[model samples]
Target: MINTILPKPFLFLLLILICAETRAVPVPPAAVAYTADIIIYGGTSAAVTAAVRAAKDGKQVIIVSPDRHLGGLSSGGLGFTDTGNKEVIGGLSREFYHRVYMHYQQQDAWMWQKKEEYGNKGQGTPAMDGKERTMWIFEPHVAEQIMEDFIKENKITVYRKEWLNRKNGVVMKKGRILSIRTMSGKIYTGKMFIDATYEGDLMAAARVSYHIGREASAVYGEEWNGIQTGVFQHGHHFKKEVDPYKIPGNPASGLLADISAEKPGINGSGDNKLQAYCFRMCLTNHPDNRIAFPKPDGYDPLNYELLARVFQSGWNELFDKFDDIPNRKTDTNNHGPFSTDYIGMNYDYPEASYAQRKKMIKAHEDYQKGLYYFMITDPRVPANLQNRLKTWGLSKDEFKDNGNWPHQLYIREARRMVSDYVMTENEVLGKKEVPKPIGMGSYSLDSHNTQRYVTDKGFVQNEGDIGVKAPVPYSIGYGAIVPKKSECKNLLVPVCLSSSHIAYGSARMEPVFMILGESAAAAAVLAIDDQVAVQDVSYEKLEQVLLKENQKLRFGK
Candidate 1:
């Protein structure tokens, strides 16, 4: 009662503090200007290749990248390339691997161990051979150096840490994009543009049509495009009954675990979600070159309870698929039921903004780092399993700037452009022929599980994962790179090429991206020569250029 009234002096002081806190700081935006004949707007492998090719073609080209680092995941610890058929790789993509071969020729490249001690066989692709036309498998820094060499040798103008404006800032006149603005208030002008980003942000901002999440099988007459619940192939599903409810078998007791209690969608139908994403962590066993995994802040043991259950289910085969690279380091990835992929958690990331995407990437990092920390240190983990995991640590030479973390997160899929020619499963399965070949993809139609849910028998399981090999290397159409002529005329999209989900699963490989990049550049140059939009580039002329560049359009005998 006595303290009900506030003192006049205290009130005045509080008001003054509030005013000071609310005051805004005035700072002028930085001004930047650039002009080029061709402008590439991503920092991926494809972006680098396209910019270099354009520069090599004697076009004044510039690369504006939001990333501080180049080469995306190619240099960001995915040293074990995901190339399907090495024979199909040519031009800049093959050149990248040759540089890796050159880097390892010297004894000094083996910083941790002897060259012979390191296994040449890596994940998804074959090892490097000096005389062979194709090369794959390399170290992280080696790839980065190769890309830098490409840029330096070509003298391509590059602007790092620049992002494009997503609003009404892409200036266009007479069906050609004149210039584009960035959030930092910088403008870039060019005759032709390539939206090489995984997310297709530039294409979207330019009023081009794009898609997010997987489409239903029915939408494109695709057999494997939608929700697939009963098909579990990778040994991740539960074999025995386990309750999904909080109380053992009672539905009224509420749902258990981290899953949203929402109804699991019907099988083979569309859903507004994408597969989970994870970092491809590079680990080393060399004591001097390894950084021990640190316990993350806000660490929760419950987040990894599923992994413990996976372990308890008599699945002791841990060191089965680790692809060993140089320096006694392994490019560790998803194995068994609960591995590196934090399933069902990265649905909204494909369309999210930079700030929101950052938060999602950080969360994935925390989850994966915590998973490792918990496995090695947690008392619940089997002693045998702990001993094996304890031998591994983050590679000292890789991602040195960011606490030994891989620079790129695996963006499995993103906004695909709904262009004139959409690649489908029929083409990949060799049921139908694809005309106007620009590139080829030979990897399996692989899509990781989109969700983990409880089954009817009250057992937890993973769903939406599919892995089926393509019948043969299928030709990627030139029309897939451009939007319908009515939508956009001057844009070329390499990363988010038009394709069905199943077909994209195969076409989504990095080498394929580089191949497509080269083709896109050739088309852009041809378009400029003919004085026509990208959509108007003649297929016969484009095919001739691709063949001359040594691109494998059709599968060879």
Candidate 2:
């Protein structure tokens, strides 16, 4: 009867509109509440090792990971491990490499190339050492699978893709964190917390003291803490003078892209600048498993103008860092003066909002992708170099979900905690003996170029690339992982532990992160059992458990 009063066509149209409105409305999922004895808030190698250790110790553990995939950079792209002294690596860290070794033993693991055909290349050691029973180098997918195997064997609970609400997520009472909430409205309550993220988001939100940029050399009585304008230890600086202006030798025209007009800061002085960040691309030349480098959206040639000039200067070191991995793949990294390191573009990433950081990450991806595309397509590149680059492409068998691009960017340095005893160059250089030894680091004190600015001589140059090798294996103290007693008592920060920028450079390796992660979990278990703050845990008790768990705390102990 109602349809008879109105036009049939109008009635039908109104019904359609009503149905569309109804479909547009979304129903939100209910908030989840989880309680655990220990809650780890990251998806890095440290997070997985921490969760495994906690679960092994008979403690209920939960991993609230922002990442959909496990193993941060270890599984992301850096399959070529950076093991300083393999003897110093112990506990779950060594177990990971052992697993890699076991996997490579199967003939199926050698898909692209035969096991004997792949040479044993590594960082001052064999890639697959039979005597040691460890394989330091591997593929991205293999590493992820091992991490998955770890959690599965340990029966650890993990909630992936849950980002921490940095603003009002961390709830603290009486100098201890009670619980934390994620962006998905899920609440996680724990007696002890571990901030294993490279960004240190939970640690920062909990009102813990931290440092973003380099500290002055005088601040901690160290020589390599701050800016280094002229020192070039890694040969990444421009060997030849490259003009910085749009029109060569003419200062009147604007400066070329990627060449800053600012003066290189005074050496040994402090600034808010941070080390460069880029993706560790996994590439291969096998035609069957290669996807040509994509021309990302908003491709621009000007971004790599400086690199072209470097090529023109007879600098053909672009392939210097294409370190080989299994299956004939490469773990490509920043090499030349103007390579993949997006210099000076990540200074604000340490404290940026989530949305802003994603934009920055996307910008880095675009810049790097454009660099590869430019190398292959640009006329400025040498014909021979371009031809050789054409042989290589992104590994089709790797990172298949995101078009063969790595999901995690290499965040070399970020917010580092500032606890009571900060590790400095002195501690890393073996000048001072550590008090409560928890782990060991023997890598070089390495920091990539922080900025690219014009020198007073009117040539573009890179600054902040310092590489100082440690004299011997140095011990990392327990105080470096826990926060101050007054700030937060129950939180342990392993990946972003208390260290100077120079000290962190040596200790930030993936193997070292796992060592600290396992040690931190042992301490957390002890603290929870004693019903005390993490800082109050007895070092003797922690050392006993670490040694029992096969964690190499001291050099020869």
TM-score of each: 0.92, 0.95
Among all windows of ten consecutive residues in candidate 1, which has the lowest summed lDDT?
Answer: 235-244
lDDT of each: 0.81, 0.94
Candidate 1 lDDT at 341 equals 84
Error of 1 at 352 (Å): 1.4
Q: lDDT, candidate 1, residue 37?
A: 85
lDDT of 2 by residue, 104-132 (tens): 99999999999998988999899999998
RMSD of each: 5.7, 4.6
Query: Any runs in candidate 1 off by more than 4 Å, and if so which?
Result: 1-31, 123-125, 239-257
Query: For residues 487-519, what per-residue lDDT tens digits would candidate 1 score against the true structure?
Result: 777889999999877678888888888888888
List of clashing residue pairs for candidate 2 = none
